[model samples]
Target chain A: MKHSIHMHSLFEKLNLEDIQVEDNSTLYGQANIERIRKLTLDKVRKDRKEMSFSFKRQLCKVALVACAVLCIGGATVFAAANEGVRETISSLLGISQEKILKVGESIKNKDYKLTVLELACDSYTGIATISVEALSPKAQETFFKDNIVHKLRISPVGYGLREEAPDEYRRYFSFSFKVSKELNLYPEEGLTFSMEGISKKITIPITQTVELTELDIDIPASEGYPMSYQKLYYSDLGFTLLGSLENEDVNSENCLITIEFMDGSISKFYHYYRALEQVKSDNRISVAKTQASIGRSERSVKNDTAPSDEDTIIDFDTEWFSGGSNSINSGKVISIFSFSKEMDWSTVKSIMVNGTTVRLH
Target chain B: MEDYIIIKRLKQNKEKALEYLIERYSSYVVSIAARIGGRLLSIQDVEEIASDVFYAIWKNRGNLIETGSLKPYIAQIARNMTKTRLCHKREEEPLDEDMLVFSSEGVDELIIHKEQLQFLRDTISLLNYPDKDILLSYYFWNYKLTEIAERFDLPLSTIKSKLYRGRSELVKRFEEGGYYYEA
Candidate 1:
């Protein structure tokens, strides 16, 4: 092709500004005044008809609300208590007051609110358990003795995993009272609780924020090999447990980055969910490391000097096929710390263990 | 509410239907009419021509379809009205024939092409914040390599590399987000 000739001809083909602007003047209105009322807007909207999936899907909104209400007030709570010993305690005792339960008396009543607020639950082998950090109304002190949180039952709702429990659905619930009226309330204290007959128990402990250090990871031949990859350096590994009510893409499509905290909680940061409509989603991004690992910070990995020693490593193993197109060589490991694209030296978090996968909570 | 519906109820009347129709698509009709008018005539003259086009559509609504399409139907009305307005205003003098070549490129085809472009615009608004900004600034805004470098505060080469890689990233994300279609 004649490079200059082609360029000149292309330039003559169309005015780039006119092509860019097209007839999209309505989007950026002219310097004029106009007022549209509700009826006028609705009429115009109906005239310019278009199909919307979100609105169609929203037809099921009423059904979902009804399900939510029924699941909250039913026998689901008892299911947790009978399912396992750990769940039995967590259902009734509340984390901080786990061990402080008497036969019939409730020890830390004020702390119950805190425990409920911070409730975290996990289930294994059809049994569910919950624990939360609780503080007594009084300062540091131990006043309660070994007591039991009786009548433990958990009501398990078919929350996200509706397909998992087709045979039977169950939830959990628990309630406990001191054996005699002589037992009075202590202002501040700590304790653990378990179900009446089940071994499932929950104990709330003092919560504290701890610094994260590098956990070196060696890619076994088991996953794949890297062709050519770059390294990224990050500063601080700001870690937090994935809570239910937070800004997250836990259920986004093809999000391979899952962060597991030391406290048995899990969260995923799928970057593909952040792209625009014209972009294709790359499935090669592996989120299979289902175990608890450090989540890379989006802000810390800017293109500058490395921030600090607290940074975490995200080892992206981009193994290209031998016949793959472009410079993407098959079998390449490009490790990035945080969101930086430049290659840098680093490793994974220390909290992650080998041979065992840390699943997200 | 019923008055709005009453227009639809009286779709059989030629003049009444045309009046309601003009009131209905006035904004879109005016804007598109303005675009064509601005290029061919003065702004004030175009505005007058656009209003006249609306009046013509108002007088001619009985001939229009009830719902299948609105744009193509109105575009035809605008074109005819514009030709009439131009002939009366420019009867004594004529413009260069070459300028008319630009106008000859079927405005109707352009109108149809605009529907697809509007669909693309709607799709962009549905994207997440970061992805939407990056794609719009790079493509629609058309900042050059050095300009982007200064704006994003990065090395020129880094900006180039990022633009190359970011385009690919966006392509992948767009497909994954179910926006892009395989050829």
Candidate 2:
């Protein structure tokens, strides 16, 4: 599927207009354009702040947790040790002992597996490092297996920790995991390390800008409109479009169109239309008192056999509301009650809510 | 009769508001569905989704933080609705919130890139003659820092500084124009 899409795009790049013509099949016609526009406009109105308060609160909570943990455990350990040991541990940890102490204080009796690995700091210094490692429930089995040890190499003096720490603050440590399987990893953007227990959730906003090129769909000869292809032409307001196939016997409606010609532009017909002379001047298409089957392309069900007993009537009621002063003055207050009902099943037909009626099937 | 007044009416559960909303945004919804190439849902389906969005907004109008940022807010809602419609069509796949994460990982990158390009095009069209020329020469025309300085008859450092500030200003404009910050 991906390969075909790539090929489709390649063909598109070779000819964009043509490619777009081919692309039109993927999009539904212009029927729901107003709805999409409204929804989009509403979205812009909802979230004014780039980052909401909840997000900030969540970040703060994580920070507080880390601080509490570090203070409870990490501070005591550093305070008990000598200055040299403290310096050594700090170098191995890469972060200031204060930060570690903050994290340790928050952790209360939680079983934590600690790993101490001799590694090189970022400044090429050899350092002893202590870090937390979580062997997820699913990976514990394989991780404990007797796997081949790759190599044991450490930095000379100021190890990988020195890389993150500036030359002035050369005392730091670093540790890394060596996984056997491929892993999808995303480090904190512009930085490698993140605060402990902080969750990173990404939200993407959808955006789009489009220019409507052209509409050239052929309206088929249906019962409603019987206009010949050549006789129907458009002049700015409306027109009829037609299509032909090599096999004239094939169903024209179902035939897939190839909207490509010269200049790398491709055009496809959305639907056939027969514009009435009266409404052509308005450049608008509307259906009034029209009984149109939505999914008509499907196979028809033949009901030659007569039904024995069928009750089509659905019990319904009417709900009404008075229009405003202006609407009442305009003589538009009266709206008919269509359907308000209770049924054994969930289907409701015509529903009159307030003053408007919705046709539901 | 104004759009905002209509929105207020919708919030008040006035039936006329529904008609007004449908009349106003139905075409826009269809256009959005068309752009995304939503094959599972028809234009009518898009209308239903848009209707739901409006209904939700109406129900939660009091809770909305920024009423003025309507366009981007509605854009995000429509986008979410589009995803929901697409996901529901895949009945065999177990419904997982994480599926949205998977869909967003790579596909959104393309969308963001397209938006940025569009924003840049708009910015180019909107900038003044001198600023536009400087931007076009430095960025679009790919003129070297020294070359831009030489062409504009300014110091190389000045040219670079202006370019930097111009880029930053353009970013701020894009942000204001609803190009959301990802991080």
Candidate 3:
């Protein structure tokens, strides 16, 4: 063991591990870009590439849309609302249609169009659904085909999470986020949507709130693996989970949190449904074959066999043990200032699902 | 955009230039920050360090060297900032000896090593995801074999056996790349 492998090369080779730009490193890139987008361009207000003109102008623009709030009967909600916008809002904000107050409005400039189609509100959840469509058909073609985006600084008027559309939808990009309670109040004023080299504001508003039922989920120690754990927090629209494995030996082998809602509608939450949808997509990274197939898992290494169709490569990151839960809690849980009341742990009935101990009060 | 163009824009006090650089080198910045911070800094802390690195570079744009590339400069700043954060968290003076890995190496040797490093990197990408991740994290990130085993929920023997295969794969790549290791 006197001569060992030089650790330096490996260190440097893995240098960009966190970035992995050669692959889909969007998880990190999105965060960094979002942060940089907040940095003001300090240019003319007309071009929004991350510049804010007057706050008053932003407000007045949204206010100009007379029917910022659309009145739809409970049964006619789907018929009255734009399907694309409704889906975008529900998917983006992790809200249900019932929670929306106003939707389907637009503002545009010469380059891109911005529309706020759905606004869901709770006392604190002000999730706005906004869509930006490029004016040029050629630009839209490239966007849809290549999945490349202009270095536009698109910021929600509030503090919220952003979920961008897929490549095909990039030309008519849609996003939703939970904004600050203050920002929610001014939803009529759309966000400052800026392009890589241009800028503009889109006037629209989506506001309505749903009080999701919260329950205390209690788990017995036996439910978790020696070092693996799963916590599923549910709301009306969807649930969230914080799955972690304390045991480092597992290459993320076992993480299960199956949900059973009172309604057979597991599709109620956008995030959960989306994950299932992506896996359903023909290009999904399918589950890997168990190395223990022959009771000799080491064969995977020795034979150096090309991975079988049964053994798909898992591009996994152990650090992000959290998944399956929808983006936001049941419904409009956006807004920094909105705080929902907690569930009383004592009132829930304890139950079991697949040997996982759970308290469902 | 070219490095020179970005530098020129930064010099002109255009904030978007900084944004462009951030988008381009974000992965590089994150890797450096996480490496230097190790397990000491939280994600928030590491993020702040990365932000500080970019801002520091932008702040001192006038002093940048006009040759080569800005990558090494950015890496140096990122590592230094991370070290500062680590020192603050540990409440100790910077340990220069621990910071230094090798006292010196021949210039030619260094050059060859960097070249070979490229070979290692390409091979890393070529390897399947699981094997690549196992080798890189175990060797580069300083994660213990047991730690990895626990994290991935694999048995200890399985990890060691896989690691042995990973090393063999490494050796195979070295031979293929026209280099020999003194094993």
Candidate 4:
């Protein structure tokens, strides 16, 4: 079936009021507004830093894994979809988020056959649930039994199918890669989906961005509430964020987001990362909650501990924590929760812990 | 003005075209970045991705300009850049773990993502600004519902209910064939 999206393009989907086009300085109250020249210069500065002979280069191929307990549909589930595609993706339409395609539609190529059972298409990622069967018994035995599958790589480099894990049966496989390379959300013609040597491609006629309710929150401010979206819209009372970890390793995935769209300026952003698996309720010396914003701390890097006002870090530690291969029991979850960003302290009307909401106003 | 004219200006003068595009679509870029891998990236990283996306589009002005629309191109570029950024992050600073679990591919659980993005897109387009922005950021950019509710100073209960209502409304619209732009 052809998909017919309502917009001429993805840009048409954005609300006009959200478009802030005044000069960065006037809008953001920044002392200096950067011109394209300075932005270009920053690019030059980066290249120079990279080429400097004294700078040591490191390609840290850390095997970062996000072991999520509590099935809160963890944030990293889709981003770090290194698990069986089945485990991470569910039906967008069904309550269980079931698959869109089925295995009944299988296609074959010479000595082997391929079937695409599921297709997960977002603006950036297109994941296919595939089933492969060898025509010859010998080939099937070698490919499945000995796990001599690495030799047969998927094609076309970046757009090619990656050798993820198979389903319960040895025949099923899943692959996900970038599809927005040609994501003309509103092309003169609609978009299409197809894969070579895998399945027939079809033009997706429609694409819609899901609508959540508009928040009618206005943090009453005397200092004329900061213009930043977060500060203006949500930052009222100070609160903490807690998370459960799949592993206890020095995961560099932890990040802090701070920038002023009004001024088009960036401030000092501190990057901190740590993964905790062993230090849960059993060892964290906590009673009920595995993690709460009040008691969360950094379990890695002790040397240079500098806290900034942009965000808060309450009761933090310096020891690095990591996890083991065995998935921690869901019952006894080993969490690596840390403090996320803090609001304006005064603007918060409510505090959210996990899914539970508390009125703080 | 047509996309080509704007692009022509870009080709002749880099700064002016960039200024225009940036003024027009910076929020759009951030929205998409958040949808794709915004949670993993800092705002600076998102900015870097936006800058690079514009630069790439400018460099390939010939192909895109003729298309007469920069919206889809921008969206596509934003997505590609985010994907690239995520891939790079996975390679360089992916969450550090002692053990790596290989992804499992399944056959029985195979089903289309049910074209959910399409219906959601149309429903969102009908929303006013902040509402549309909130949903886009939450779903496409992976922002937490609670975070979004907090951002808007709304209760988490309110946000979840609205999302539920909006989603239900969208499915109803689809069932009724109400929001089809192509027809």
TM-score top scorer: 3
**What tens digits encode model 4's per-residue C-alpha lDDT throughout A1-361?**
4343322232234433332222211212211224422453355335323322111111001111111211222212111111111222231111123323332455455545554455443323233445566666765656556432332233211111223335433465443332112212123333333333434443333222211111222121111111111111111011112122323342212232222222333222222322223223223211111111121211222222222232322121111000011112221221222111111223433322221223333
Ranked by TM-score, top first: 3, 4, 2, 1
Q: Highest DockQ, which number?
A: 3
Give the CAPRI class of candidate 1: incorrect
User: Which runs in model 2 stand beyond 4 Å of their true positions?
Assistant: A1-23, A26-361, B64-69, B88-183
Question: TM-score: which is higher, 2 or 3?
Answer: 3
lDDT string for model 2 (A151-225, tens) is 112111111111122122122223221100011111212112222232331211111111111222222322222
For model 4, residues B1-183, the per-residue Cα lDDT tens digits are 566767754543233455677666766776676555423455566667777776676555435545667888888778778766654211122112211122122223223123334544567657654555444444334456666676566887776666555545565656554333221
DockQ for candidate 1, please give it: 0.02
Model 4's CAPRI class? Answer: incorrect
Per-residue lDDT of candidate 3, residues A198-310 (tens digit): 45444444333555433333232222221122333333322333222343332222222222234431211110011222334544222211000001111111111222232
What are the candidates' individual DockQ scores?
Answer: 0.02, 0.05, 0.06, 0.02
lDDT of 1 by residue, A237-323 (tens): 112111111111221111123334444433332111222121234322212111223323221222211112322222222110000
The Cα error of candidate 3 at residue A281, in Å, is: 24
- Pairwise DockQ winner, candidates 1 and 3: 3
Tens-place lDDT per residue, model 3, B1-183, is 888878865554444467787878767877666544433344566566777777777667656665547888888788777656643222223212111122222346556567556756766667664566556546555566666677456897887777677666656776675555554
Looking at model 2 chain B, which ten-residue stretch has the lowest summed lDDT? Answer: B94-103
Candidate 3 TM-score versus the reference: 0.27
Best by lDDT: 3
TM-score of chain B of each: 0.36, 0.41, 0.49, 0.48
List model 1 lDDT by residue over B1-183, tens digit each: 233342342332222234455456656655555443332343444445555655454334334445655666667666666545533211222111111011122236555344334433444445543343333434434334454455446686765554444444433443443343222
